[model samples]
Target: MAKTAKKIGSSAERLLKVTEALCAEHGLESVSMRDIAKAAGVSPSVIYHHYESRIDLLMAVFRQRFGMLLALRAPLVAELEAQAVPDVDKFLYSIMAPIAFMRSKGEDGAMASRFIARALMSSLPEIKAEVDAGIRGMRETVDIAQRAFPHLSREEICWRLHFTFGVEHMTHWDNERLEIMSDGLCNARSVEESITRAVAFAKAAFLAP
Candidate 1:
């Protein structure tokens, strides 16, 4: 029974891995179940056995990626909370570091970043809802923000978080835009440097009245 469970789990993971790679290569809207099944070297029926539909598979991929990211950030959040003075800098770093780490991970990370960005801001109602449901990390970040800036209302903290999201999205997704705008002077290719600048910018925005 344990061996059988392990085999099932392995197949499920392969499906997700193939789906992630395809989604990263081709935008989410374009990747089909047949595409994933073919990539995973499995029959479409087999894929269906594991996931009910395309959306289910996509949601599973997003949840797994975000779950990993949230796990990485949770400890940082706790450490910040334990601090005598809530260091907003450290708070921002804790929130942004997981994303930076994801961005540093090559193609799979890029796909996760793009999916997350779209999930947060997508216009498609069904897709947006599923993606939003997978966003525990964002809520956790909000909790930390509220704790860090107790004087600020939730609404205010969320607005500031919006700006921080913009910074992070740009750093991860459209990293080269800065280079184009700055005429090649400000290099945004280095993930560490990009996060440093973004944290600085976002940290100020959060502290702003």
Candidate 2:
């Protein structure tokens, strides 16, 4: 019984991994069950045995990956909630640091980071909701920020958050566009430097009239 259960768990994990890779490469709409089975070294029936459909498998991947993302940011949120005086700089730093670190890693980190970037920026209504629902840390950050600056209206906080996401996407995702526009003076490869500048910029925007 134990061995059978172990095998089941392992296969399920492998299936998810294969699905993630395929989706990362070809995207969710283009990937099929056969594609996943071919990559996982399993039959289509095996995939069905574990997941009801492609959507189910994708949901599993989002839930697992985004759950890890939230866990990574949870300590920051906890520290903020515990503070007698909420510090916006610290809150912004806490949120930006882990994500910047994730971008610094090699291929696996790049893939996960891109996955999250796409999810957050996706225009598709269903995909947007799925991504938003899983990122509890993002919602928490907004609440914490509101408490820290109660004078600001919710609209003001949300507008600032829009710019914050833009900063994170550009800094963390690393593209040549920024460098090109700046005549190679602006480099985004330094995680610590990126977070430092990002927090400062966001702090200014939040405090701006």
lDDT of 2 by residue, 65-181 (tens): 777677777788889999976888998887678777666677776677666665565555666678766655367777888898899988888778878877877778755687788
Per-model CA lDDT versus the true structure: 0.79, 0.78
Query: In terms of lDDT, which candidate is strongest?
Result: 1
TM-score of candidate 1 versus the correct structure, residues matched by position: 0.83
- Scored against the true structure, residue 117 in model 2 reaches a CA lDDT of 63
lDDT of 1 by residue, 160-187 (tens): 8888877777887787788999999987
Task: Report the error of model 2 at residue 110, Å.
Answer: 2.6
Candidate 2's TM-score? 0.85
Model 1 segments more than 4 A misplaced: 1-5, 121-126, 134-140
Scored by TM-score, the top model is 2
